[model samples]
Structure formats: structure tokens, C-alpha cells
Target: MRIAFVHRRGGDDEAVLGQAAALGRAGHDVHLVAADADDLRRTPGYATARRTVTVTTGHGGDPVAALRALRPDVVHVHHVSADPGRSWVADWTGPLVATLHDHHPPCASAGLHRDGRYGGSRGARLPLAWASRGGTADDPLLRRADRLIVLSETSRARYTRAGVAPERLALVPHFVPDGTRGAMRPEPVWVYAGRLAQEQGITELLRRWPAGQRLDVFGGGPRERECRAAAPDSVTFRGVVEHAGLVRRLGRYQGLVLPGRFDDGLPLVYSEALAAGLPVLAFDGSPTARTVRAEGTGTVASWDASLPAALRAASLVFPTLRAHCRARYEETYGETQWVTGTERLYAAVVRAGAREFA
Candidate 1:
């Protein structure tokens, strides 16, 4: 099958390209449409076309003509620029579908989580982000997608409110390959991957962690210096680590500390951690945390006054946490989970001839 994946990126966007690359490796003809090449060179099977504008989510030609040129069996979009009104695919006809990786339509910061918290007033939610050039995702383009895929139930709820019909929302997870999972070997190094954004709450995690607890902070962000300063003497800053480095790094950590206050669907970062056999310590007051909270796979708290105690208890329950995290990964997000869920969605979209309601 010929699948064209589209996303406009000015950053390290392996998450978007990883899906197409994995699909290609799994026997599909995958093509990529994007705004940059620095990141693309590293992604296998990635092919690019020229762009007429910087943020238009459309190809240079007419929407129909552009898609027609690709002749794709499926069009899987991961993002649309803030002006989704300018996105060409909005008018195209091939199995229209996308994964709402973040709250881009309703939130300019895209996390619907800003000022380091989740869910706020419309003004706060819609800051700078517009699904259409002039309109928020409250109408039109959001409703246009045949099916809307979200990473977590928390994201599904937000999208549903953002005007994507609940019927159209599919909770399809991001892919995390077995090769990505690490060998959680020795020591109790708590891991924090992804950008060290305060929205990610890594600063709070370090500040609140008990003294003497060793932590490894990976990924760079605007708050890198602050995170470094707030870190306890036990913490180590490894700077920016790639996907493989992440897995190798996870092997040294007993668990991952992913206390994000943002509604970023399910971060493949956390998914990657679980696959690596590292338990998660997370706090998100939304259904999104269900994956990690289900029956002790890891500890999930509300990030309220009660959170610090929960974190302490979780550290003590390391043996149980270790056992369950691996179990949950095997049962729900292992090799089978990655391939089965994605191919199923692709096949269904192709057969139905439209991205059906999930």
C-alpha cells in the first residue's frame, strides 16, 4: 500500500517519521510530506516534496492535484499547521485521517496545558492556535476528518470537546518497537526523557523527589538550566540523547519519572519507557494516565497535595512496580501491540475508503 504521511516540522520530528518508517519496514510504500530535511535525513524511507508556503498543510498544487499525484491508498496525517484552514488535505478525498498528537487545534501551545497546568478558559485554550486560518477547531476542518485518532482517552475527551464527534475518535496508540525497549538492568536511576519543559514538570519531579534518589535527565528544553539548578545532588544531566541512547540510558534506570501536567495524548516517550521495562511515575489528572495507572503497572497520582506521598510510596514499591510494568508492556504495548494496532487502522481505512468513526 502507498501511504503518504504529512507534518510540517521545524524541530526534531522523529515521532511523525517513525510511524512511516516502521510501516515501510513492515512492507508498505510510505512517503513523507514535510517542511524540513535536517530531521528527515535520519528517517528511513522518507521522501519529500517542495513547499509553496511555510505553514500551509497543503502541497504546492491544488489539494486534489497534490494528493492525486501521490496516489496513496491511505493518507495518515500527524499534524496540521495552526492555520489548518490552509491545509490542502482538508479538501482531498483519500481516506482522510489523522492522529491528534497534541491539542494543536484548541491550544496554541498545543498541550492544552500551559502555565504548567491542564485545561483552562477558552482564551487560554485557544491561544494562537487555530485549526483554520481564522477559526479555532471549534468547527469545520476538525469535523472534516473522516476519523480522528487520539493517543489517549484524555486526548479523546479534549478533541471531542474541540468539536471532533466522539464517534470519530479512535484511541490508537503511538508505536513503540521492541528494539526501542531497553534492558532495565541495575541501580535505581529514575529517568526523565522528553524535553525538560516545565510543562513536562521535570523540575517539580526533581525538587519533590526524596533526597539521595538518583535521577537521569535526558532531552533538552528551554528550562534546561532551571532543571539543572533545581536538581538534587543525586541527579545527573546527560544532555540530549537520541532514541538509541535513550534505550541504552533506560537500562541504567530502574524506572521513569514522567510527571507531565500537559495533555499530550500518550507520549511515545512514556510508551518507550514502558517498552524498556522501566516503570513510570506519572501524575496527570485525566483519563490519559489510565495506561500507566491500571493495576500497579506504575503509580499514578493527581499531582495534587497528595502526590508527593504517592511518589514516596511508589519508590518503596519498586519490586511490585518492576514486575507489573513489564507485564503491562507485554500484554498491551509490546511488539504485537505496535504492529497489530497500526496495520489494523490502515487496513480498515483502506477498506472503508474513508477514515471511519473509531
Candidate 2:
């Protein structure tokens, strides 16, 4: 079968590349059409695509024509929305599978975070973001898809609450490539490996990070400069590193700190950390936190008065959790499961025809 995988940006580019390579290895012809070549070059296995096309916009005649020229068996789309000028893939026939990586359609902030917290009022910013040239809700596009894939149960609940049919949503975890499992460091050292944004609560973590604890921050974002400037001596900013490089670095850390306050779907960083045999430290009740607690892969607590104590407690169990983290990744979020689940979904979508719900 021939498949055309479409994505506008790089957020889930790694996963797309993994799926494409998996499909190719399974003898299915796969084509990747993206807006950037840099994203494609970042990952190792993207060369598996039978063809990789670079497009300016999905709505443009060039992208649509390129896709149409392929005559794909099924078109798997990620992060395509009808937001004005960014409206890529207006309307395509046949089986269309869309993955809702976040809460972008129902809530403009995507993670439903605003004013430095989750589910707060976006206030004036909401309307402005919506009215902007590149602003459009994906509800309509999601409704049109033959199948809708979500990364976690939290995401499914959020979308279902926003009026997407539960039947249309499938819970699929992100793929984590196997990584070198490292021995837990004797010293209690942790790393925060994600964007330094307001919703992520990195600022709060930096402010509250215990004096004795050592934290090495990774990834660069809009708030990088501010964070680095305000961060204490215990905190070191490593800026952005390549994905493989980040995984290699993860092997050296005793624990991974995900200070995010939002309900993240299966976070790639969390999975990568676990794959590298590191337990996670996250806020209580958030998706990653819940998984950590449930799987005994790490500890969770409120970021307020309870965080410092939680950090100390997690460090004690770090070695035990390290084994579970590696085992959990192998059993659940690893490449084999992702490829199998994705291929099954693609086959189901193609067989069911594009069913429209009223």
C-alpha cells in the first residue's frame, strides 16, 4: 500500500519519521510531505520514505498538487489545521487519518494553558490568537477525518469534552526508540529536557529548586534568555541539543524533572528519559505524573511546599525506578508497539472508508 504522511511542522516530526520507516520496512510504500527539510534531516530513518516532498503550505496548489500526484492509499495528517493562510490539505478524498497531538482545535493554547497555568482564561490573547492570520480551530478538519488519533487518555477526554465523538478517537502513545540504559548516578543529579515556556513551570521550578540539588536544563525556547538569566547557580542551561545527543545525555542523569503543569499527552521527552533508564519527577495529576506514579517509574508531588521533599524522596528510589522505567518502555511505548498499532489503524481506516458522522 502507498501512504502519504503530511505534517506542517516539526513537533511530531520524529514520530512521523518512525512511522514512515516502520511502514517502509513492512513493505508498504510511504511518502512524506512536510513544510521543512530541516525537520526531515533531524531524524535518522526518514530516508526510508519512498519519496519526501517539501511544500510551502498544505493549502497551496503546490502541496495539494504534490499530494494528488501521489494518489496515496491513505493520507495520515498531523498538525494540519484550517487556520486561515496555514490551511493545508483543504479537503482530500479517500481515507484521512489525523492525529490530534494537543488541544489546538478546541483551545488555541493547544495545551489549554494560559496565564502560566493550565485551563486559565486566555483573556484578550485568546481572541487575538484566534483572529490572527494563522489562527484556525481544527474541529472541522478533525470531524472530516476517517480516524482521529490521540496520544493519551487525557487528550481523548479533552477532545471528547470539546464535542469530538469518542468513537472517532484512538489512544496511541508516542514511539520511543530504544536507548542506552545507564546506571543511576551515585549523586542526586537531575535534568529538565524540554522547552522553557511559561506553561512548562520551569520558571517556578528554577525559583523553587532546592539549594543543594543540581539541575541541568536542556532545550531552548522563547523564555530561554529570561530563564537562564534568572536561574540560580545550581541550574545550568545546556540550550538545544540534537535528539540523539539529548538521549545520550539522559543516560547520565539520576532523574528527569518535568515541571509542566498541563496534562501532556504521552510526552516524547518523558518516554525518552524512561528509555534511557531515568525516572521522572513531575507535578501531581498531570498525565506524565500519573503515568510515573502508576508505573512506579518515579515520584510526583505538588510544586509548592511539597516539591523539595518530593525531589529528595525520588532520589532515594532512583535506582529501583530506573529498572522499571527501562522495562516499561520496552513493554509499552517502544517502536514495535507503535508500528504495530499504527499499521492496524491505517488498515482499519482504509477498510472502513471515510465515514461521516452527523
How high is each candidate's TM-score?
0.78, 0.82
- Candidate 1 on 97-124: residue-level lDDT in tens? 7776664455455544422334446785
Off by over 4 Å in 1: 10-12, 35-39, 42-63, 84-87, 111-140, 180-184, 284-288, 301-312, 354-358
Q: Best by lDDT, which number?
A: 2
Candidate 2 lDDT at 250 equals 87
Give lDDT per model, in order.
Answer: 0.62, 0.70
The digit string of per-residue lDDT tens for model 2 on 78-113 reads 755344423444456667888776644454565343
- Model 2 misplaced regions, further than 4 Å: 35-64, 83-91, 111-138, 181-187, 354-358
Look at candidate 1 and tell me the lDDT of residue 157.
73
Q: Lowest lDDT 10-mer window, candidate 2?
A: 53-62
lDDT of 2 at 169: 89
